[model samples]
Target: MDPADSHTDEIALSAEEFDAVRAALARVTSTGGGAQAHSLLAQWSALVDEVEEGYSWCAPELDNDLSCRNALAKVWPLLPSRVRAIRQPELDCIDVRYRRATIPWPDRPEEGARWWTWRVPRRLDVEAAERRDPDWPLGWEMMPFPRPASVEVVTWQYVPIRPSTKRM
Candidate 1:
């Protein structure tokens, strides 16, 4: 048998395997899992870069590449609970309560203590109600127009996504 032909017999990963590797790497990378996880991710990234750039693979390099990917897959599941708990922030609509009242700060009555606070959604339609046209006098007024005495500006909150029920 030709020595060079042996290379062809080495296992090449299928597309599904590649996808699994990528998904695990992406999750660990996004969380900044830890020094060890970062190191393993870096190794996997380097392997991907080389593969993409058409680097010639020696037997040892191919073995190392496969090993690195497998190690990363294993490490991802074993990350510290706190690190695993980390997640990307998501946009969430919140309820804001504000009232027309004297400003608490001096010389800023117009900008006054209008003292506004936000709370989790009392219901999903809060955003729609806050954004709709004024109902007080039954007409829409453009900006710089007086807002009702007590009005809430529907806004968003940046919060870490929950593990379950991913959507708001």
Candidate 2:
């Protein structure tokens, strides 16, 4: 287990916990009055339990397609607005591995659209690595998981929206 890995895991876990807390808060506020706070708390706890059970096997299946995306989506709403905006709204599941590759935007070539790429780093386990590799390698101090990386965002280049003129 590398220290970097531990840190990454910590960050990811913290984010997950934060989201849970936020959801509880939102649920409480949705009721719009103090009378329902207690009931909402009970429901919130149950919801948390359900979420935990739902993701119990998430770590092991991080390499799988749907599972990985589901995990990502769990954290998606918690992400900063700008980051969330970068992703397509309709995308339900995203493969972490596939997201690491460069994605091409061929639909808007006229406006000089190019490829977009991003990499989400993997979380590391520091303690496990120490037992396996006595001497930690350079760059191992960094988080094992890839951080969100992105290419230049194409603000606007939609051909469909462009006006076409024909001789009258």
Candidate 3:
């Protein structure tokens, strides 16, 4: 009996049937890799499409127009979280320089006593290099492109906030 026919009593394998089985296994592996690559490319393509669509309205001379800002904002939330992470540090560096430091509460004794001071950084520096490019989208400088694989997203959830009256 041929090796392929040894199990003929249970099942039979023809040349075409053997080839079909091989092809199915190959497809399964290919699909897995293909899906991942497709996902990554889709993300990249969407970002490029958004940038191109927003380009005409992004001239530096058009900075004062609200339409330019609104168009860019439409795509802002759809950006992948990863992209945002990559862009944040660069934005932070630029923001720190342009921000004006002011005491949050300078008057009203009670308000001043309870004031929770925090640095309110500028949204974006209009005078900066990135903002000066006419071809650049108005808020592109603040774009949150995710960092490379070195970074990961973390989430923390906790109970509701309740004010503590006890002074430490």
Each prediction's Cα RMSD?
A: 24.2, 21.9, 25.5
lDDT score, candidate 2, position 47: 30
Q: Tens digit of lDDT per residue, candidate 2, span 23-74? A: 5435434432232222332343333333323322222232332332333334
Total backbone collisions for each predicted model:
2, 15, 8
In TM-score terms, which candidate is top?
Answer: 1
TM-score versus the correct structure, for each prediction: 0.28, 0.19, 0.20
> Total clashes, candidate 1?
2
- Give candidate 3's whole-model lDDT: 0.31
Once superposed on the true structure, which residue ranges of model 3 sit more than 4 Å away at CA? 1-74, 101-168
The model with the greater TM-score, 2 or 3, is 3
Models sorted by TM-score, best on top: 1, 3, 2
Could you tell me the C-alpha RMSD of candidate 1 in Å?
Answer: 24.2
Off by over 4 Å in 1: 1-35, 85-168
**On a 0 to 100 scale, what is the lDDT of residue 11 in model 3?**
28
Model 1 is weakest, by summed lDDT over 10 consecutive residues, at 87-96
Q: In candidate 2, how many Å is residue 21 off?
A: 6.4
lDDT per residue as tens, model 1, 86-122: 3101000000111111112222343322111111111
